[model samples]
Target: MMDFDVELIRRYAAENKIKFGRASSKAVIGKVIASMPEYKTRVRELIPVIERVVEEINSMSIEDLKRYYSPPVKKKVKEEFRLPPLPKAVEGMVSTRFAPNPDFVLHLGSLRPLILSYEYAKMYNGKFYIRFEDTDPKTKRPEPRFYEAIKRDVEWLGIKPDKYIYQSDRLELYYDVARTLIDRGYAYVCLCERDVFKKYVYNGLACPHRGQSIEDNHELFDKMLNRFFNEGEAVLRIKTDLNHPNPSVRDWPALRIIDTETYRHPRVYDEYIVWPLYNFSCAIDDYMMGITHVLRGAEHRVNEVKQSYIFRYMGWDPPEYIHHGRVAIPEGVLSKSKILKGIREGLYTGIDDPRLATLPALRRRGFHPKALYNVILKTGLSSSNTTIDFSMLAAENRKVIDREANRYYGVRNPKTVYIYLMDDVEVKIRVHPDHPERGYRIFRLYRGENYIYIDFEDEKYLEYGDLIMLISLGNFRVGEETLEFINNDV
Candidate 1:
């Protein structure tokens, strides 16, 4: 055993427990220490220090230490293994992915997950892949422009995925795994009608074919395949325990038959009968892609658990799951679908309409990518749902722009006002009051002229004969709230 400082470890561990949850102290400390590249290399030399610390901690009274060091509750051990020897080189472990279905353009909700994945990948020096989960040809509408838009948005936000993978390209891989599962007696074909199948399975009601062997169902499946599936019949399902409390654990559909009219595969020339379900395809892809960290919205938390079972059944290592909240727009705000509808109906100009939260709209509104990044940092990662005020984002944007942008005078909504001049003179006016170094421009004035151009709102504050100031120039008495300017030349 290496010599370690037991007392120091106890103090550090107690402080960590107070900071993080009691159960998270060790992991938190380990993570913190591992993050320091310099310290990671000296871990072997530091083992003695850790041993001494543990020894001192062991000497403390169990009852007294209970107040400081709350041991975590023991969990049921599903597997057992001895700790491996520390490696010579510190390996970057985190691998995250942004899996977006190509059905719609990326939204604020999707941006949150991408940001989390990107940040984690950067923090751990890990690889992050942008995977297009473009399954379900029935619902998939491949818009090349949408993919281009997403790429531009991600790049603008300073996020770069290590590689781009498409689920459509991996259909053969999914089919191979599906066949493996079927061969292993882990999945079975169900030849039930769509509506009837959903009603029975979702309600947890037993079907007559529930416990039928795959071999026994093969002939029936063939008949159904020929009559319904090939022509236009059957769905495939995983044979999980029906008594499992979670409805998701009950034999869930792994594949479904699609109508020829509704389906259009990108690569497949002929109409296909079977299609991998969401959970099945996602689990297989994540495992194959070596995704170590699965960071996604909390809405998919249940789906992650189901995927975990799929991984377990296949004897594959399940990735760490981090569920973050979904981003919800204010009520009555248009959804992406509604926005698309608006575009189609000519209700709005395009996807970049200023009212929507699309990246192009944000860019046009003068919002910097750094400001959007700061918003994500401030929001952090939470499993609970959170709503962000649009104004809050606007405020952050203003701070960034105000620091770098120079003020310019723009006479929008201008109206003619009159000011009496005793003599004809040329006045020099600075283009910007605060930026006097930018120099001045000459404006010719007319003798006996009583009017100049000003915004209509400015006229309201001026009394008929009240003194008004033209920025940086001598004050002038307002003759009257007149719309006439002294000749177009002046």
Candidate 2:
């Protein structure tokens, strides 16, 4: 067996644990083999020695590892939340996707998934994707501009997706999957009335049409694709246990007919009538795109549970899920319908309205992407819902822009003040108080009468003989109608 320093291995493992939160034996062993020149010639015999070192590292307690790896001088560290550990299986091959409906622009709450997926993908040196879930062309009609707008929004956040996909372009793939499910007796066509079906679903009972033969279901499904059935006349639902606790999982509807003529799709107008719902299309895409991990809102937990039935019937392993809490802004609206209505009603501007919490609006308001990232990183992945007041966002944003934003003075409802100067004064004020290298604004007041403006409202607080400092200039005395200079001590 090749010999190695036991103490060195312990120290290295401790440091690795500090960095990765878990001591990886493979990494530790590889590091040892690379560092020791003797192992180059005896690589085959080093396994036993490496295994012994691995056991030693694994035996170290969390407290011992932290104490061993900590810096000598204690300092207060930032108490920021971090993403929980990723599954070991997704280490190098991690792939994540952000699916956005192109009906509207992305909001602050939408950034949670985009940031998490992109960050996690980057953390593992993996791939990130931007998939437009614009399959619903009727109820959630997608605008042509929003596709590009959403892309620009993600790019503005400094996240460039490795791939871009549109569900409309992949209709045939979804159709084939749906057909396969129907043929395998795992899905059926439900022609029952919409309201009646809902009533049946609520009671954890299957509709009468759920017992349709696979052959009949396949024929009806083709008719659905062929546009023979009108909207709401029929729907395709996946097979699940009738007595399942969650009524949503009891043979949930997968595909439904939509009248594309009225609410036409921008990409593929009137091309298809049968469109997949959120769960089915999303689950299929997640599997088809090789997504290893899914980071979405806790509101999608029901979707996850419902989609698991599809994955099980299709014999595909579902991706690991990380559901975070909802982020609400009390001062800003989150509803897309309400925002759009407000825009139409002339209550606000477009998507970049300052009152809105959209990514574009925040960008226009001088908020940096790093500040948003910091806020999201601190929030981490928790199922507990959170309400983010505007002040909280302002405080976070202030930290990012305060260092660079230039300073200026302004007076509202201004009135002129004449200063009778006894001497010339040169005033130099740094553009940014924290950064002098950015230069200053200079004001040269010559000996004579000089005029400056102050708010008209300030006259109420002033008295005739009172002395006042004209900030950056000098002190002056308030006269009966005009101001007189006292000294240039300012």
C-alpha lDDT of residue 127 in model 1: 86
Q: Give the Å error, residue 323, model 1.
A: 1.6
Model 2 scores a TM of 0.76
Query: Tens digits of per-residue lDDT for model 2 on 1-490?
Result: 3355766677777766555434556677767765674665675676666666656655665677765566557464654556777775466799999999999899889878899888889888899999999999888888989998998888888988999999999889989999899889999999999789889988877789888899999999999989899999999999888888877778888999999998789999998888999999999999999999999998888898899988998999999998889998889887888988999999978889988898888888878887888788878787888777666677778767876689988877888877787778889998998789999999888788888887665555567776666666766678987788777665
What TM-score would each prediction reach against the true structure? 0.66, 0.76
Clashes of each: 20, 0
User: Model 1 over residues 70-132: C-alpha lDDT tens digits?
Assistant: 556756443222222121212477778898766666665666778877777777777899987
The 10-residue segment of model 2 with minimum total lDDT is 17-26
- lDDT of model 1, residue 477: 50
- Error (Å) of candidate 2 at residue 35 is 51
